[model samples]
Target: MKVSLIFPKLPETSTFIGTVKEAEKYSKDKIEFYGFPPMGILYLATYLREKNFDVSILDQFARGYSVERTLKWIKQENPDVLGFSTITTAGTGIISAEISRRVKEEINPNIKILFGNYHATFNDRRILEKYPFVDACIRGEGEKTLLEIAEKVEKDQNFEEIKGLTYRDNGRIVRNDDRPRIENMDTLPFPDRNLLGNVEYKNTVEGLELSVGKFTSAASSRGCAFQCSFCSSSMFWGKWRPRSPENIIDELSILEDQGFNNLLWVDDNFTISKKRLLKLSDLIRKEKFDFNWMAEGRVTQSSKELLNAMKQMGCKILSFGVESGSQRLLEWYNKKITLNQVYDAVKNSKKVGIDMILANFIVGAPIETREEIIETLNFSLKLDIDFPQFHILGIIPGNWIWDQMVKEKKINPDDCWEVGTAVLPIPLSEIMERIRQTHIKFMKRPSYISRQIAKTLKSRYRQKAVLQNIKNIERWDIWNSWKPFWG
Candidate 1:
């Protein structure tokens, strides 16, 4: 059967602006560097093709297609089954339902519509209840479930017996038993990069490429070993599992041969196991592979030796989730790492000549005071990091924080659609004001100001990028601030 898998275009208000227009506008007229392939759907398409089915991927986000354009394309494909790989961010999840509705009503009503990935996995019943256009949701890992659904549709069989599926029967919602997470990482086929079709992916620092050429993302492992309350990763991905070093390297070899010299390991926590990491680094160096890559590291697990070895393998950047500088808040979030660990990790990475150190901090968690927020910002300024990103905390669904918020009536079940679309009315004026002040203080540092001048004078691209970064700091003012979450 002909199948079409789509990654929907994000809402305009989405904080994530990876497309050309949004990226350029938000980056202060800098070069765009945010677009990346939807690896999930690509993997699904590969599995479907391996099963000898005709499959195609519509990467609306990467291609920057509009809702109308996406609908038009799906109508043209007219596949027997249409699947959307969705996420519960920036209202993309709710918007996916609308897109599905349009496909069912305006296009071929006979087509089976399926939604999968993080959002669908958690809110399967809600989706089936609210959006009649969506036929079913493939909860958790989707490869096996999706194949079974497609097979059923092809053979005109009922979906009643399918596990890991949530659908409607006789106007009543029916959610099947949950599917187990895929334990064997090597059993699955490589993501079908061919579905990407000339779509070039790259990783950049200060508007320059990470390596000599283009880059794409890969996963060395799945799930997080730590349980941070503000995160939904553990609930969705279950336990942490790493692929064999040989399996990871083999994929790297494929990408390198295909002219992708740089990679961004999108693992939830690549540094969870130091032994596996050192082994992987050794393999990369021993194989004589000349490629630059980046990965997220847990501060508690990072060490000087691991950072140094990763550097030897062309590790250009390492990101750390220093969620808050406040030790109290860190413990509240169950980060399980002290502020000292954060500092040491940064120091070690800097010593190893890691090109970039990107630290992520969340402002406005439960009971966070104005002073504590400033303390976090001040702590970030003192760190030996190249870049830092500050974002307002979200009460994500199905997380420990979400449950607490529900208990306190901070969130209402009726507002699920609103929350999914990121339209929840939470006033963040105080937080936004602090963000503005923090940016001003951070940017005014003598060394930072000097680096800005040097980089701006280096090239047109660098000038634009640096100026844009400066403008973004100013853009945090109340008038230009993002919507705040209300408790």
Candidate 2:
């Protein structure tokens, strides 16, 4: 049986402006460039192809296909089963449902429509009940469960035995028992690069794209060891599981040979295993693999030794989860790190000569005072990181805050899939204004201006996007204030 997978295209950067830079797109397209590949679906495609299934991938997002064009292409493929993967963002789930509806109603109603990813996993039952088009959802990880579902569908057998699934029985929605998280990540095959076509990606920290040439992402591990209250990464990936240094090095070598000179380790926290990281660093140096890389890390999980080793191995950037500077707020967020730890990590990372350091801070958390928000801003500036991303705290699904909101009747569990993107503790206009002020106060300094100018001299793409982000902040102030009108 043939299988088809589709990924809806993401918005252009999701912040500064909605339009893609025509000149940049043209220049990049000449070299077969695009954003990061959807590793989730690519992994499933790999597993299915290994089992002798005819699988094809339609990356509508990377291809920049409109809904009509995507539908037309899907119809041409006309596979027995079609699947969609999505994350829980503002309008992503609703968009996925609409696409599923179009394929079912317009393309071929007989085709089985499957959904996967974070949004689908948490709202499986709700999706099945609300949308008649979505036949089933593979909750959590999809590799093994999706393969099992395909085998059953090919043979016209019952889907009841498949765990981590939510589907319809007759006319009613049925939720199955949870599936165990995949413990042996190394057992999984490398994601299907052939299915991904010639899409190019770049490794970057936060919104800053660092690599000048072709770049790609890797997962040295799965899941986050820390259960921060605002994040749902732990809920999805379950426990933390890091691949052996040997396995990780093998993938890096393959990517290096594949023309990927820069790499981004997309693990929840790349520095979770200090021992493993040091070993990986040593191996990378020993192998003489010439590749620049970056990874997300926690403030409490680094040392001078590790940072130096990473820099020596060509780690140009390191992003840290510095949610807040206030100790009270840190405790409330369950970040499990002291302010001292964050300060020390930043100092050590800078001392190690890492070219860039990104600090992610959350503003407008529930019950957060203005003083606390200001403290976070001041803390960020004092750290003097290369990049800082100030995000307004929203209730993320599968997180402690979301659960509390549901219990408190502030959010309807069944109908509030968009709560994560909406319902900020503070008004969005206020949040944006504070963020604008914070950015202006920290980023508009002479020193900061010099640093950005130097960076722009190095990266031509950064010149436009970075300046645009600063210029457009004022326009967003007016736009955000009028958000309700647009809604």
Candidate 3:
């Protein structure tokens, strides 16, 4: 049976920016600019293809395929089963349902529609109940579950015994037992990059290429050891499972040969184990492979030794989730790292000569006082890192804040379309203003502007990226983004 997985576009806002052709052009600009491939879909596609099923991927968001074009592609492919990778952010999950409805109404009515990944995993029943079009939701660690599903679909068998499956049975909902997490991650095949088919992915900063190389993302570890309450990762991924150094190097070696030199480790915490990095460094050095990559680090885990090892492993950039500078807020968030540790981590990364250090700070928590908000902004200025990304804390399905908000009746759990607000959400306008003011305070300085201008003069790619921004330079939205905020 033919299987097609689609990563649906973000829901149309304002009728998708005018005429369909203009909208398509606008979408192409949005899609072609940022984000790497949808690795989850790539893994699923690879697994299905290996099982001798004809599987294809339609990354509508990444490729900028409009609703019309997407439906056209769907009609042409006419797969027996259609799966959608949906996320809760920005009503993308709801859009998947809308697309599924179109597919059933306009294209093939008999195709089995499935929703998987973060949103569906948490709201499986809600999705099925609210949208009757979605046939099933394959919950958590989808590789094995999806394989079982493909087999079931091929044979026209019901999803009775499949683990990690939530499907309808004769107009009644039936959710199977949850699937256990995969312990030995090494057994899983590397993500199939060839399926991307000449997308020319690049690592970009404010639409500027960061280093001008082939860029992709990988995850060496799943989940975070420390479940910071505001995070949804631990809830979604279950636990921290690090792949062996051998497995990681094996993937790296393959990635190098595939002509992808620049990479970003999409792991929640790549430096969870210092030993892992030391060993991986040795392996990369032993292999004599030349590849530069970036990864996220926890301040508590970012020892000088670890930073040094990461430098040896060709880590060009290190990002730390320094959510807030206030120790009180840090404790509430369960970051486990102290203000001093944040300092030490940034110090060590710089001392180790890691090219770029990015620190992320969240402003406008529900209980966050005006003083605390300013403290975070000031703290960003104090850091000697390459950049500081300040964002308003967002509420999603699996996060602690979301649950608290739900408990407090601040948001409805069944409201799958909207990102949940914090327990005591700071008003949207106030939060946006605070974030805007933070950017203005950080980036609009005459010194900072002149410094960035000097840096821009040194790189032609950055100059081009800056030129591209001239059209939208009047936008307040630009300042809201980390890279463009400073620029």
Candidate 4:
């Protein structure tokens, strides 16, 4: 049996338009290239390969789309099954649908097409109804379920027995019972890195001095225990399941041996287990492994002692969700961390020489007063972190906040952006203007802007590039554009 997994490429501007400067600074391109290695697809590929299925992975991000070329490759390989992974909302789904349509129409009509990931998990019914080219959609974690489905498809067996799958039966959508989440992550084989050929890791952006080589991402756990209303992890994974420290260390050792020097722990919350973290740190230290790692966790999860120990154990960076500065807003969002925790965590991280990135405020949230927005900005600036990202509030389809806002008459169901995937009723002009004003206010702070400008100057090589960016901002009038909204 032969199986193929495809990660459809998307326009760089679509993904990183708001953060172009940051993207360019970190990578050689003006956009954040690639979709972070499509870990889910790789996991499924590994499972199929281990089961003796001929599996191949294609990343459209690195390889630009040429329908003729892709179709030619498909025809030449002639895989028995095809699978696509998608994210929340229509962005990835639309791309997957187009590819599926092309395959059905141009390449091979008989090839079984399947979809998985967050979007399919939540919007299976809608997808089935709209895109008939997709033979099935897998809900929730697909590593095991996908293998079962692939076996059935390969053998021409009944697919109804497969759990956690939605498929068309006699012109009706049939959704099978949900599959149980995998508890033992250790049993799963390490991801198939052969899928991503010639992997190189530098900050990718022009001016950054940090060149941690051939970094690979690994998930130490699944799900989040906290109730962050805007987050989809809790809804997707249901409950938290962490891999043992030994298992995690084993995988790290594998990656290290494979010439990957930097590791990114891609868990929703890596700091959930202090004991496990300390144990892993101790093991890394004991093994004398030379690698730098980064992870995202709650702001309050680490202490000065634990952070210091993490640095000693080759942890170079820490990312935290300091969503808002306003205590009231934080409480409303169910972040569960106090303002003091943010301050202390930043202080401790700085003291330990660990780079820090704060996921900052979500602008234009319902009932959000202008004062609260300013307060959030002030809090972000007060932290004095190495990097901060301010994002507009997007009500993703599966999130609790998305449903709640709709129920409360806060979000207009018809309003959408980013090719109808992002929910934003507010005019784009208004949102962009607010962002520009926020940027100006953030840059006005000499201490903060100086570091940011210095970083940009250091990262950018060609003077023309910097000037062009400045000219682009000037033409856009990001600061002054908010006048219509103010009135």
In candidate 3, stretches whose alpha carbon ends up further than 4 angstroms from where it belongs are: 12-32, 416-418, 422-425, 444-487
Residue-level lDDT tens digits of model 3 in 1-487: 8999987777765112111122244444333335667788988898889888998888777666778898998999889999998777656677788789999999988999999988888888888988888899988889999998889888989999999999999899998999998898888888888876545454544333453466788889887788898887887788899999999889988898888877888899999888888999999899987777878898888878888988887887789999998999998888888999899999998788776678999877777887888788788877776677766676778778777767877777755334444443456666566666766676666776685666567645446545756754442234444443343
Residue lDDT tens for model 1, 380-403 = 898977667788887767677778
Model 4: pairs clashing at backbone N, Cα or C within 3 Å:
25-205, 26-203, 26-204, 26-205, 27-204, 27-205, 28-204, 207-459
Model 2 lDDT tens row, 1-487 = 8899987665443332122223254464432323566788888998999999999997766666678888888888888889988766644566677788988888889888898888788878777888888899889988889899889989998789999999988888888899998888789888857687745554333333455556777788888888999888898889898789998888887787878777777889988888988998899999998877778888777899988888878887789999997999999899999999999998899777776789999888766877888788888888868878777786757788888777878777666574354445657787777777776677668988897677667744455446655654432233443343233
TM-score (C-alpha, index-matched) for candidate 3: 0.88
Q: In angstroms, how far off is 483's CA in candidate 4? A: 21
lDDT of 1 at 56: 90
Global lDDT of each candidate: 0.77, 0.77, 0.77, 0.71
After superposition on all C-alphas, the RMSD of every candidate to the true structure, in Å, is: 5.3, 4.8, 4.4, 6.0
Of models 2 and 4, which has the larger lDDT?
Answer: 2
The deviation in Å at residue 320 for candidate 1 is 0.5
How close is every model to the real structure, measured as TM-score? 0.88, 0.89, 0.88, 0.84
Q: Where is model 1 more than 4 Å wrong at Cα?
A: 21-33, 204-212, 417-427, 449-487
lDDT of 1: 0.77
